[model samples]
Target: MRQLYLNQAALSARATTVIRDADNQSRYLLVGKWGLRADVLTVYLIDGSLEAEVKQESLGLLPRFRLLYHRQPVGHVSKTFGVIREVLFVRGLNWVIMGNLNSGRFRIFHGRELIANIAPVSADGQTIALEVDQPDHEALVVCLAAILDRWAKHQQRGLNPLKNRGWAPGLSSEVTPFITQEKNLDRRY
Candidate 1:
């Protein structure tokens, strides 16, 4: 099981997530595209090394995401039955991200073990907090959070966020703040 935290949150694909250890020393910088020019998610270690790359594989009911470490396939995070997100780690430490995108609340799990939970820490929905059990897996875990985070937004709206959105270096439309409208779907029992 992994328990960690993602603090100082902001609404940006090119993000910097703070993970405070017992002494508050580690941080994970989410480096990726924030515009339409690129399509990739890279999590770089603080020491200036590529930790993991999350690439979108396909577009469908549940889009598939591939985790590449050292240019090798490590695991796969995909939507299960067009609903919950499942992360199957081939190496070790598999996780599952479950939530309702409508509410924007998600939880990470290692099998049945709860690893982390993500929810809006602020009323504006611009900031979020992720609580995880393992801090060492902050890079991989947070990278997955980024992926699942995108998934939640995608689930909320019928449009694909990646198709019309991206993160650039600087001075881009992505840096400009915007509003997200949530569509209220009709649920029949």
Candidate 2:
């Protein structure tokens, strides 16, 4: 298995933005410091739309784990401490749900309704299945790619505020705008 490291600098620079209107008057964003832990980890949902709390579990000198999405926290098999390898998002009826690579589970709430849970399935080497209730695969993929691209750019720039390097360091000028435009289109939907 391949090991992943949490880019502390990138994590600290992580920021998510939510806009409500064209004037950008009602925009909300969450930015904070993040860390990784083997025993217990806490992930905070910054936007006003969601709230989360995570706790460590105990099993006879061993540690158990729980990840709480929204208001409910569920238990899962415990594993050794390591960096978060990936972040995943699935589009539901109303919400763009997020999850980590290890857990492989996500929840989406659209308005007051909770959509179906998404899971991965594989039948052969070439066939991969992402079980989603909605069929907007193109929009979903674009949104996820945009988020990941932003993260990658942040990581490549060393996430140093003092130096404040932009994404030009890692991506070609022509490709960057295309990515930004795609993300903007995704947000409109």
Candidate 3:
């Protein structure tokens, strides 16, 4: 197994994250961008060649992403609503991701075979470690990690801290910040 490390809490618009190998040598670079309707994330090799690209195609309850390797469609990753655990359906590659993705603990499986294992490397949850079964799939794994992190962050943003034991159910977390700002304004008035 090839052990890789991703040193980013989340990928934001205009942020670049580096994926390093076990020896701390940079293996890939993930550059994130804000698209007109969604987010775009691209992966490049250490030498600066485009390895793969992931574009968020939709921003609904079940988000969908398109994956490209060498600018060719490899497949797409789409989240499926589940009450027990997070599940991602990877078309084209016929892979499935199952487990608690928000916690950064999940496994990617291709059919009955295991492809990779992802988990937080630090207690602070700042760094994530990936153990991939093959070296050639490293680039794909990098792209998947970025998308997974992005989706997890998106889920968190929709949560309402004041409801459902810290979950807002139908309300987006964006309102909380605005509500806090309004409270500050009230105090000043």
Candidate 4:
């Protein structure tokens, strides 16, 4: 049950973003970029170690991403269309990520059991808290949070976030149209 926070924009995920702990100290980084053949994304430690990675399974058909830990497949993340719009596959855990488009809050669940929470995203950054029963899935949960945040940002722009993945420091989004989710859509009675 390690507590962590995300204070960066995922839609800018083409590069990298530094994540920190509750003390505002840098813990790890989330990176989404291009590989030699296709898109590549992963999380790393400050000492430069691989925590988790994303590998595309098929390019022609539905985009499916495998979550790799130390070069081994542990889980996967796939895009889907639905009324509530479910996305992200939590591999071995068999969990799916879904949230209110109107609310910044997103929850991870293993069937009916609540796993983690990502919420209170501000102009500064988004925060993630994990309560998974297994400790090993920490990194995987973080990556899922990034994927969801990036996906949501793209949704506001009327496009697919999977098509453009990159985020980090010292990168101006002007090169690519970047829009961060600011406020929830207000409804009138």
Kindly give the number of clashing pairs for every candidate.
12, 2, 1, 11
Between candidates 1 and 4, the lDDT winner: 4
Let me know the TM-score candidate 3 reaches against the reference structure.
0.78
Q: State the C-alpha lDDT per candidate.
A: 0.60, 0.35, 0.80, 0.64
Q: What are the runs in model 4 whose C-alpha is more than 4 Å off?
A: 10-13, 34-37, 58-62, 86-91, 121-134, 159-189
In order of appearance, the predictions have TM-scores of: 0.61, 0.24, 0.78, 0.66
State in Å the error of residue 37, model 4: 6.8
Between prediction 2 and prediction 3, which has the larger TM-score?
Answer: 3
Per-residue lDDT for 1-189 in model 2, tens only?
111112223323444422122242432222332223433333322235433333444543223444445556432333234524342322222344445433333444446554433332333211112233443332232122223333444455554753564445455464443356888899999
Order of candidates by TM-score, top first?
Answer: 3, 4, 1, 2
In candidate 4, position 78 carries an lDDT of 62
Per-residue lDDT of 89-149 in model 3, one digit per residue for the tens?
Answer: 7899998888775687889999889999988889888888999999777788888887777
Q: Which stretches of candidate 3 lie over 4 Å from their true place?
A: 10-14, 34-38, 82-85, 161-189
lDDT of 4 by residue, 1-189 (tens): 456776544436465777776677887787776323357678888789998887656553246667788778878776765524655556676987767544557778888887777666455445444344454666777777665655566466555353345543446454665445433333321
**3 against 4, candidate with superior TM-score:** 3
Q: In candidate 3, how many Å is residue 18 off? A: 1.0
Deviation of model 4 at 159, angstroms: 7.6
